[model samples]
Target chain A: MNESGHNGLVERVAHELKRSIKIDPSFDESVMAEVRRHGKPAMWVRVIAWWRRPQQLSLSPLSMAASAAVLILAVAVSPVRFGNPDGVEPIAEDPAARVIRFELDAPRASSVTLSGDFNDWDLEATPMTRTSSGEWVTTVKLVPGRYEYTFVVDGDKWVPDPAAPPSLFDDFGGTSSTITVPEV
Target chain B: MVESDGQLVRSVLAGDVDRYAILVERYRDRLGRYAYRMLGNLEDSEEVLQDTFVRAFKSLKNCQDPELFGRWVFKILVNRARTAGSIRGRRDRLFVTDEIAILNASDMKQSEYGWREEIERALSELPADQREAFILKYVEELRYDEMAEVTGVGVSALKMRVNRACRRLRELLEGVYRE
Candidate 1:
């Protein structure tokens, strides 16, 4: 075949190939139903839901009362030393190094691991222990810096911490929670 | 005035979930054609299309450029078609010629020529990458840059794939046309 003949054949093929199939009229409605079924809440809605969730207090009432009483007794026993009698000022202790407790409510998860920038995103670095109340808990001593992290449930399923600040979507198509550890 | 895809995307993101139907209606036929050619079956194509729309709706916010919503959704459709194709491959034999497709082709041509079957056979015989490149280039009439954006492959590589696909397709269908 000549050049134009081959070109004509190709064009014919393209034309035939480009023919639109008659889609089912109800396909759009079916797709919309599926979309509604799997609808993701807006970012602000997720934020509001997180905000409205009931918080679990870490300390028992008896322990809190005892701590308050001890603090009051210590303040009463200590002399009012507004400024040191000596000319020297007391050196402040380093507050950058501290432990932050991370917790998640995953009662059904057999194992939960925490991975983040702190541990180079290693899945096995920090495994969370399940409390009797079915909360997965872990406390990691992190330096004062912003860290991105996610919880791995059952060795897969990376999930962002619900209680943490807003998360950014990672390159791997998952969201990572961000935490800024402030100096005490 | 008709709203652009960007406006619809924004409305959907702003809690007007129903606005997404506009996008689905707009792109379904076009994307459905691409999926039908890619998968060679209407049922699989519809399944992939449904999946693509649902995914696009859920991830509408993650779309970096709402103005390029068509391209973004096309990319998702391509990926879903690939995945669905492979899964379908494992479960069933590849490429069962659809009776409806053949009937439609006969209706269009008003003749008994089975050119559509031959073309679909030729297309199904090509490697997935080459077939995708060819369909995007010729049938979809996408530029190399746009093809690159959709497939995440370099322009030169896509060009080579399209060339190879054309050569292979012509070879496959040469006897059919000669007859």
Candidate 2:
């Protein structure tokens, strides 16, 4: 009995039979078109324009370090909210920030505040605006160092800041993006 | 042939601006076939091929060898396929053509053979890695070393995969073996 209990020779012969390929007449043209799509655009200006764009999303800071921190918080932890829209957004720039952004999908609690080392554990440095999506954002900028923060979901709940850098030590705590503020 | 891709990449990176056509023309067919076989979906295959070329073009500077453009491009396609494949719950099936090809493969009646469909069904039954090794080595006709480079697997592991594929295929084609 062969491996499958079939005539091993016939199976071997059949295995010898390769899939006959009929390269579609259009195959070359279509793949060429794809090639063209991937190739830089014919227009120098356009190709240059496309080249200027970052290949992968700059996960940390998207350019405007200040705007990034605010947008960073907005884009991150997009699921919750700080109590009200009543404070200036702190601009934290330096060492291109690396952070995981999430949108708050729910409403703010009566005692929503951001707490982190940047604020010396102050839950009142800045208030967050509640967007229609129920997102609250705060830009907490720290020097080139690792810091931990969380959202005071409500007065009693001490939750990690959703927009903050992810912390892998959630076993003892939660997730936070490790921001590498470059030393200029 | 590989030199052309390298030249195009250099030109594209240096802002020479138009040498990419040669690279595209040179690689489109081969990479398309590889991508099609890897993913089975025509649109996705095409997308992966396009993306592979785009990424390969963009990251051309980082490529260690301008000479091994084929291998480099294949790696891009493989990575793209693997990433996309991982996301899908079902494995992508492989067919030689981007869309179904009606033309016949090279005549091989020199050996008594089972129906093409049976071979395909059997070929599909092997695990993904084994099937990959089998197709690349036997169908695509890549050498064991080349398969290792393309797959990023060690040669021994690739051989194991090929052996497993042959064994599984034999089991799948019992009737042929019986005959």
Candidate 3:
């Protein structure tokens, strides 16, 4: 075919290919269902639940951070207000909740957040504070259970915990590090 | 004024989970078409589309520029389509045109149906990368930079692929299309 004919064929094919596709009636509903399944509870509600649970705070120093001392607090002894949004007074702390510390050495990151199934994978639910030594740290009082989580670096990059075991399943292009807290 | 994609993304991120439906609805058909053309079947395309949406939702916080959500999701869809295509493999792809033609036989005139079949056949004949480059450049009408973002290929290489695809497609379709 000549140049004009070739161009015409390309344009014709483009037009044919651009025809609108037929989507199933339930497409939006189906997507929303999946999204809802991953929806998270409010931070305050989770924090409150954490306070009410039995917690035995253990300060086991991880091998990755030899100088990074773990902060252990007796839940029953300390008055804790865990960024409570409702301003509800802290209830009497239960002595059984286990405080697990998560740390990442990201000296350059301006911010880091923890996301996991335990917190319904809510990224904003757990922000990690930066230490003077440049390790990002946050402690969550999780009850005895298996949890899959990744650290959000600089609010946009997801990094799995190097010190923890990787979960068997990687989801949505992010790998999660799994930690199993045994029954206290 | 209509809400920007960024606005919708913000609402969805700020606990308005329902706002996500807008984003899904807005991009579904376009992305579905791309997936269908790339994967050569409705089942595979829809599955890829669904996976792309769910993946985007799960990682929405990682979308640095919410205003470009459409592009971001399209990138995910491209990757998923590539994976699905590779896994399914093109070993049985000779019949893909027949499968699609039969499925839509009732919807078009006989001549139009035959022509469409020829086009799909020609498209499926191109290597996957060339086919992808062709479709994104022509059918989707994306600029070279945008195509680069979606496919992660440099502009010069993509231009080469598109040229080769057009030449190959013309050769494949000439016999049937020429009077």
Candidate 4:
């Protein structure tokens, strides 16, 4: 075909391709159903929910005084823990749970948290510590299983790990990186 | 007066969940067409389209420009279609487009139907990347810059893909047209 004829064919094909298929309103309803199910409370709402959640404390006046006296006596005897001034204690490792280290390089992020199937996708559950070089790192003890996760950068940005394989799209329409722990 | 995409997005984010239906309605058909063309079947396209909207609604707060919601949702649909296509993993499975052509046949003239089927078959034969670039450029009417944003591909590569796609499509369908 000549140049103009070829152009005509291409344009005609493009026009036909652009003719959109008829979509039912039910598609919108199904999407909204999913959105409603995945609807998250705003940060303020979550904060309020946390604040208003019922927490219980039990103490008698006599017991409180006794506890304070004991604390004061212990402090006087040792201004700080003799071997550890910071009073940090080592955590015991579980033989059944495997240690997996998760890291993300987010130098500009004020904070980063790891959320996944392992943590019930809770934003605050697995706060990562910032290293001197600006990488955020955290270790979790997980039993053998496949888990999907993402890094929450600067509190709200959901980012999948660039170094890991991505998981299939979840029911909520998000894709997180997947890690499979082998049975050792 | 019809509300701007920004207004509807803001309302949806502000707890007026019903307003999201409007956004879904506004973009579903356009996005559906892209998905169908990309995936070459109705089932995968509808699934991807639904997921795109749900994902957009779920992540509405992350949308940097609410006024450009359509573009943002189109990006999601593109990503979803890519993933769906990869998972399906074979072109033979895409013969469902033949079923779609038959369903659409009643609405089109006989010659027009045959030409469209030839085009769709030719489109489905191109490499996924070329088909995607061509569809975004011509069918979706997206500019190269916008296509770059959606596909995360550089403009030069996209232009090459579009050029190759047009050439290959013409080569595939020229015989049918001449006859």
Candidate 5:
């Protein structure tokens, strides 16, 4: 009787909650219809967006403090982060004289590839082999300069670093991280 | 009826606006629920969800990960809800979009305001972090990892907030939800 009572309790709670709100089945269609009202996105949109960012950008100490606070909020409030032992190995301290590492917490991806301006945006510059725990890791030698980079997972999807340095605002209006590789 | 999120993103990037429909369809329910939970108003949730997609589409190129579509949209929705809530607060009436009457109905049932008011007041009493954690974990049904992606916080803190929120909620809803 106790077991039956517990089951009944769960059912009643579920029923009451389900009765509270209603959502349309075709919500996606409506939203898509709304989006199409503006037309298709431009090909090379990211590249174009990148070129249009405030070209005269500069970083200052004050900006760093503000960005750090915002960063802390973004970090603490967000449910995802970089460097999980059970997630990504967080690149074992770079050994090369001028080393840069790219990591993504993609446990399901078979093979990850590194691509960005550092490789002249070459898709084949460095193909990241997966590790036992499933994160993809890759490193590239670099000269002291800033670079834009993204991870190509299993030959599909572009993922940015959720834990990198400040990214400039795209003219299209979202942020991506930037890496200012320092001189060794 | 569908393509992988990556395909849709590629199509969007390649100028196929229609592909966006799939993503909208894919995430519409989740996004709506998230908005509704956060704002507690269907109308405001709809508005926020609509605006989020609009902004996302306008800036699709910035969506670095199509597979992480849910997370990306979630981040956008979080920002929009915060903005909407703040703006509504200035009016001192919450600018409720079609939910106050229904949820707030219970007040008449009791000599006091009602169950709806109690729920809202109790939720409002929570610190933002704890409330967000509870809503996402319990109401949104997000796995801890997915919640992490959306909030960018450590799992331990999230666990603490959810636990505290649950304890507080049980205390607040003693007689109402208990029955």
Candidate 6:
């Protein structure tokens, strides 16, 4: 057969097949029910639900306010300095800051470095120290916030923190680990 | 306004679990037809469809682009249908008599059009890969690129499969067309 005739035949077959097939109405309902049975709320929804949920407090508002007032009065009455009373020097210590220790096991690796949102993914910014037990470890002070990071092994392979939450695939086709440092 | 697939996907991911029904409803018919054609049976097709939707829901977050949700879900359905078809094929081989009885019953229901029966029989006789390629290209009217994405096969190979399928189908249905 000529190409056009062949094309016409194919189109006719497709149309006939298409016209003959009809999905049962209940198919969608059945599928939806099965999905509902197995489907959980998306991650974001669960997080929002957690946020909107009412939290119980041990102290009533009136009592809590009264306690706060009393504490303020006591603090005012006392001569204790919350910080440098001279006001000449800035406070060097942040009570909300926390020291987070990052550890990775890389016995076969010659070197390991930590890189993440904290260090702007600068691979060389935080080099890890190898312990005698062959574990690479590093400590860094971080303020409370969410961060995505990865480890650079031997200044080449970028590996996500296996212990952290699921890593996000970056735009550069690389994986990065995520962490949320809670505010104290 | 009807929300795009991408919008619906975002809504579903934002915690509106019910919005997923919109997606299910949207693609059900098209995917059902594809699965039916691929599996050559309604029961296996529906099973694959249900499984595909559930799997898609669980992996929605990992869908790189929600805009192409149809293609992504179709890919999953295609894979599930292939697996289901394989299992069914094995069972049919073991229970050849039962398989023939079931097919004959099905053919009776579809016997209204002898041409339809001939086409369906010819389609089922094609190799699975060629049948898939032919259905996706000619029946589903998918572009070559879309077929490649869904089948994970290169465009040239898909074209060759479709060509081979057409040749074989013409040969099978020659008597019907001649009459």
Clashes of each: 0, 28, 6, 0, 14, 1
What lDDT is reached at residue A133 by model 6? 94
Highest DockQ: which candidate?
A: 3
lDDT of 5: 0.63
Over 4 Å off in model 2, which ranges? A1-184, B1-3, B88-114, B176-179
Cα lDDT tens digits, model 3, B1-179, are 77888877766765667888999999999999999999888888888899899988877765767899998899878867876776566345564864556767898799888888888889988888899999999999999988876765557878999999999989988977763
Pairs of colliding residues, candidate 3: A54-A96, A54-A97, A55-A95, A55-A96, A55-A97, A56-A96
Candidate 5 chain A worst ten-residue window by lDDT: A167-176
Q: Estimate each model's TM-score.
A: 0.60, 0.49, 0.61, 0.64, 0.50, 0.57
Q: Order of candidates by TM-score, top first?
A: 4, 3, 1, 6, 5, 2
Q: Candidate 4 residues B1-179, lDDT tens each? A: 99999877776766668888999888878888998898777887889888778767766765767789888788777767766776665435453454466887888799888887888888888877788899999988889988876765557878898999988988998878652
Residue range B74-108, candidate 6, lDDT tens digits:
88787667657666765662312222224455555
The C-alpha stretches of model 4 lying farther than 4 A from their native spots are A43-184, B91-94, B98-100
- Per-residue lDDT tens digits for candidate 5, residues B61-135, read 656666676677787786566556544444454423336436556555562345445566666565556767877
Docking class of 6: incorrect
lDDT of 6 at B139: 78
lDDT tens digits by residue: candidate 6, A8-63: 67876787667434567797788778777866665665564445444477998999
Which candidate comes out best when scored by lDDT?
3
Residue-level error in angstroms, candidate 2, position A108: 48
Candidate with top TM-score is: 4
Candidate 2 docking class: incorrect
List RMSD in Å for every model shown.
17.4, 18.5, 14.6, 12.5, 19.6, 14.4
Q: TM-score of model 3, chain A?
A: 0.51
lDDT of 2 by residue, A1-184 (tens): 5434444543453344343323345644554465456565345434544564335654445456877688878958675456545544543344554443323434745445555434433435545556766776556545565654556554335455555566543311242223445554
Instruction: Score candidate 4 by DockQ.
Output: 0.21
DockQ of each model vs. true complex: 0.18, 0.08, 0.24, 0.21, 0.13, 0.16
- Local lDDT at A157 for model 1: 66
